[model samples]
Target: MHIVIIGVGGVGGYFGGKISNSNQKVTLIARGKHLEAIQKKGLQVKSINGDFITHPFLATDRIDIVEKADLVLICTKSWQVPEAAELVKPILKEDTIVIPLQNGADNAEKVSTVLGVKHVLGGLCRIYSKIEAPGVISHFGHQPDVVFGELDKSKTNRLQKVKEVFDQAGFNNSISGDIEVDIWSKFMFITTVSGLGALTRVTIGEMYENKGTRHVLEQTATEIYKVGIAKGVSLPEDIVDRIMTFIGKQPYESTASMQRDIMEGRPSELDNFNGFIVKEGIKAEVLTPVNTFIHSCLQPMEAKARI
Candidate 1:
């Protein structure tokens, strides 16, 4: 099966590089210095497990160069989804499935609205990774797990075929019967961690170590969970406990991708993360003080980065 990965940053670079290493038909869409580096020196991934490089892999800046891929993984930031969708529309056939491995809940829906719902798949990715430098990706912690399914929770041959390819590529993948719940679960955790971490300027470990800060973190998670429940997403009852436990076990210095972006003065997914919650909360009449505060703190920073 042919696969095209749009926005070859952390999530796309790691997964695409893995598929390329397995000698699969994979093409990566990237731009700027990173694209130039991959075109010249190939894509490299540095992980705690091991490091591998894939030279001479298919890398291009033009989406038209890759057409009719069996699966197209949209790994760009949430804000970039519309532009990416418009650019890749012509490359999609009737059977082409576009999996959005992006944060926030609205990306898949937004992209699908533009490109047609039948052609879009809702997907979520779990990994601590980033483009450490040009041509290089760093996996800081956690195994890479990708979950996806049809928006309406129906199974199809296309999803199965995509699953088979991912299985062949040796990835932790799942076809969720209810991808909406899965996406919300991930959003709950991410918004809590990223909001608190970016606001505090500390890693997960440091944030959880302090009693007061840990309480604030839990409050943040509770607020997000409340918002999710109000929005009719079936979150697990013990999700807060589970998240706290996960936080205790995670790497102390680990930070959210959003937090990292904020620290580096890069455009962040704040609107998709905490800001998303705030918008939903207003609609649902759910008060989200913690998220509101985080959003307020980062708005100025994000504005500066855009300039």
Candidate 2:
């Protein structure tokens, strides 16, 4: 099976490296210094589970150069998915499976708008990781978990095949029975903390330590939950509590990639995360005051960063 990975940052690099090491025909599509580093040396992954290096069958920025791809993992940022979809469209074969492991609720929708439904899958990953260097991924926190399935949430042979590949790669994974709920479940948790993390400029531990801050987290998650439930996602009633417990388990110094991007004066998923909840809330007639507040606070910086 030939697997192609787009945007080889933390998510793509770590998972793609593992798949490549499993001896699959893996191709990495990346650009700039990271691509240079991988082309010269191999992709390096430093993980808590263990460290390993993998030289993919091919690593190039040009998608057209890839002769064939059976599976394409779109690991780009939420906002970049559409553009990535455009670039990788030329390489999509008859049976190529494109799964997006971005940290947002609507990533699959974004990709499908460009690549069509047959080639798209809804997926999300849970891991506190980032690019430690060019072509190097650092998995410093979280037991990396991946959840994915067909957009329609049907049982199929393709789903099982994808699961087998993930099993071989050796990370924690599940073929979600209801991928929408799974995607929103991760979205609820990530959106609950990500915007607040950026606004407060505090680590996950710092926010969890403050009683008042913790209250805000609850409010944020609750607002997001209402929006998701209103949109017919059927998230559990105890989702906020469950997410709070999950946040408590994160490393003391852990910060989400979106939060780190904002802190470093880089463009972030402000629109895709908090801003997304705000938009969806409006569409669903669900109140999202807390999310609106967070989005409002960060819009200027986000706009400036884009400039």
Candidate 3:
């Protein structure tokens, strides 16, 4: 199968690098110094599981030349999903399968708005990795797992084919029973930590260890849970508690990708994370005061980054 990985950041780089080791053809859409480095020196993955390097069949910034793909993995930030979809639209074959393995809850929906629902799938990834340098990805923690399925949850031949590809590539992947619930479970956790972590400008340990910030964190998760429930996602009643337990087990130095983006003064998923929850809350008649506060507080920085 031919696969194109868009936005070769932490998620894309790691997974794409893994797939490159297999017999399947792989192309990576990347940008700036990262793309340059990948084209010249190959993509390097320093993984907790192991370290390896593989040069893809092609790595380019041009979306047009990647005119055909059996599968397209959208790994861009949540806010960029629609833009990415538009860029990749002409390249999609009728049978092309696109999965948004992004942090935001509505990335698949956002892509569907551009590429149509028939071409999109729901996907979420569990990994904490980042670009350590140009063309170099560092997987510092967590066993990387990619969960995905058709939006309608149908068990189809194509779905099995995608799963087989990942399995062949030696990735820990599974077809989710309920992709929506799986996406929300990830959204609830990432959104809970991201905004507060960005605002406080602290590591996860520092944010949770401080009494005041811990309260904010809890409230943030609460707001997300309320919004998810209002939106009819099958988020469990104990999701917030479960997330807290998960957070507690995380390494103290751990931080979210959105938090890192904001701290580094890059454009972030602020709109897609807290801002998304706030908007959905209003639509669902759910109160998301904590998210609203975080969104408001971070707006200036977010705006300035774009400038």
Candidate 4:
């Protein structure tokens, strides 16, 4: 099968690199120094499972030439999903399967708005990684996992086909029984930590260890949980507690990708994370004080970064 990976950041790079090792053909769409480096040399992945280098059949910024993609992974930030779908639209075959593995609960919906529901799938990835250099990706923690399925939560031939490719690539993957819940579970955790991390400008450990910030953290998660429940996501009542415990177990130095992006003054998923929850809260008639505060605080930075 021919696979295309858009936005070869940490998630796309690590997964694409591993998948490229198999017999299937892989093409990576990237831009700037990263694309140049990948074309000049190859993608170097430093992973906890193992380190390896992979040369995709083609590595370029042009998606037009990557025709007949059997599968496409949109790994861009949540806000960029629509743009990605629009750009890759012409290259998609009727049977092409596209998965948005970016953070955010509505990524699949965003893609469907552009490419239609039939072409999109609900997807999310679990990994801690980043670009260490122009063409180098560092997977510092977590066994990478990709959870995906049809948007309506039904099993189909196409789902199994995608699973076979993931299996062949040798990374952990799951065809989610409840894809929406899976996406929301990840959404709640990432937004809670990322918003707090960016707001306080501290590591996860520092944020949680401080009494005042810890209270805000708990409030943030609780607000997000309330919003999720109001929005009718299948979140368990104990989700906030479990998420807090999960955050507590993270390494002191651990930080979220969104947090890193905001700290480095790059455009991030601010609108898609806390901002998304705030918007949904209003629509659901739910009160989200903590999330509103985080979104309001980051607006200045987010606006400046986008410029």
Candidate 5:
């Protein structure tokens, strides 16, 4: 399959590198110094699992150079989705599956509005990764899983084809029957974790070690889960227990990419994560005090980064 990965940051770089290493025709859409680094030295992934490099894949800043791909993985920060969708339009064909591997439940809807509903796929990635340098991506854990499916919950040949590509690349993947529910479940986990970590300036390990902070984290998760339920999403009753268990097994120093972005003075996906919860909570008539508080607290940091 001809694949184009838009925004070759942590998520894009890691996955794209893996696919490229497996001999897939992958084109990376990147810009600035990172683009230069990839062009000169190839893409590098420094992971705990192992480090590898892919030097032969195409890398370009121009969307016009990107062919009509079988799959387009939109991996930009949440704020860049609309503009990225506009940029990707000319390079898309009718059957091209555009997977929005971004945080927040609104990405698929937003991309569908621009790229047409049939062409968009809802996806979430689980990985602790970052662009450690201009041409380098650092993956700290073993959580490299990609979950995606059709927006309408139908099993199609295209879905299976995409899964085949991922499987060939030796990556973990799953096709969900209810993509919206999957997106919400991931959003619930990410927003709560990012908000709490950013607010406290602590890693997942530090938060888990402190009973007070852990309580706050649980309360935050409950608030977000309630908002999801109020919006008519039937999240599992044991979601808190599941999330806690999952988090406990993670390395204590593990942090969300959003928290890392905030700490690095880079723009975050706050609007999509906590900000989305606040917007949806208002519409669903759900009181999300914890979400609201964290969203407000992070607003200044995001604003300052822009200036």
Candidate 6:
């Protein structure tokens, strides 16, 4: 199967490299120095599980140069999903499967709006990785896990095929029975810490170390839980507690990509993360004061980066 990975950052590079190494036909879409590096050498994955490098079947910035793909993995930042979908549309066959492994809750919806529901799948990934340098992915923590499924929950041959491919590539992946809940479940955990992490400018460990900050983090998570529940997502009542325990168990030095982006003065998923919760809360009549506060605090810097 020919696979095209849109946005070869941490998520795309690591996963794509693994797939390509398994002798699958994989094409990577990246730009600038990272693209140059991959073209000259190869995509490198420095992973805790194992480190390996594989040259993809193709790596190019221009989507037009890619082959018509059987699957398109949309791994771009949340804000870039729509435009990236449009760019990759030209290379898609009607039966092509497009799965978005992004952080935001509404990524599939965003991609579906551009590529249509027939070609889109609801998906989320659990991994802590980022670009250590051009064309190099550093997977520091968490055994990579991917969850994906059809929007309508029908068990199609394509879903089974994709799962088989993931299995063949030695990935811990699942086809979710309810993709929406899975997406929101991951969203609840990520949104709970991401904005607060940015605002505090600390690692997850440091944030929890301060009792006061930990309290804020708990509240932030609770607000997101409320929003998820209000949106009719099947969120368990103990989600916040469960996530808190999970957070405490993670590497204390671990930080969300959004936090690092904000710290480095790059545009982040501020609007997509905390800002999303705030908007959903308003629509759902759920109170999200903590999220609003975090979003408001981070707005100026986010806007400045865009300017």
For model 2, residues 79-106, the per-residue Cα lDDT tens digits are: 8989999987888898889999988999
Which is superior by lDDT, 4 or 5?
4
Candidate 5, residue 256: the lDDT equals: 90
Give the alpha carbon lDDT tens digit for every residue of 78-152 in model 4. 998889989888788889999999999899988998998998889999999999999999999888999998878
Tens-digit lDDT track of model 1 for 59-104: 9988776757778889999888988888778788778889889888
**lDDT of all predictions, in order shown?**
0.87, 0.91, 0.91, 0.90, 0.88, 0.91
lDDT digits (tens) for residues 25-133 of candidate 6: 9999999999999999999999999999899999999877788999999999999999989987899897999999989999999989998999999999999999999
- Residue 142, candidate 4: Cα error in Å is 1.0
Candidates in order, TM-scores: namely: 0.96, 0.98, 0.97, 0.97, 0.97, 0.98
Q: How many backbone clashes does candidate 4 have?
A: 0
List of clashing residue pairs for candidate 1: none
lDDT of 3: 0.91
lDDT, model 6: 0.91
Instruction: List the candidate 6 regions with Cα displacement exceeding 4 Å.
Output: none
Candidate 4 lDDT trough over 10 residues, lowest sum? 60-69
Which is the better candidate, 2 or 5, if ranked by TM-score? 2
- Model 2: weakest 10-residue lDDT segment is 61-70
Per-residue CA lDDT of candidate 5, range 1-307, in tens? 8988998998999998888889999999999999999999999999887899997368999988677888999999989999998988988887888999978888998998998898998999988888899999998886699999988788888899999889987789999998888888888778878988988889988988789988877887888888888877778898877887777777878889889889889889888889888998899898988889999999999999989
How far residue 109's Cα lies from its native spot in candidate 5, in Å, is 0.6
Candidate 3 residues lying further than 4 Å off, grouped into runs, are none
TM-score of 2: 0.98
Alpha carbon lDDT at 69, candidate 5: 86
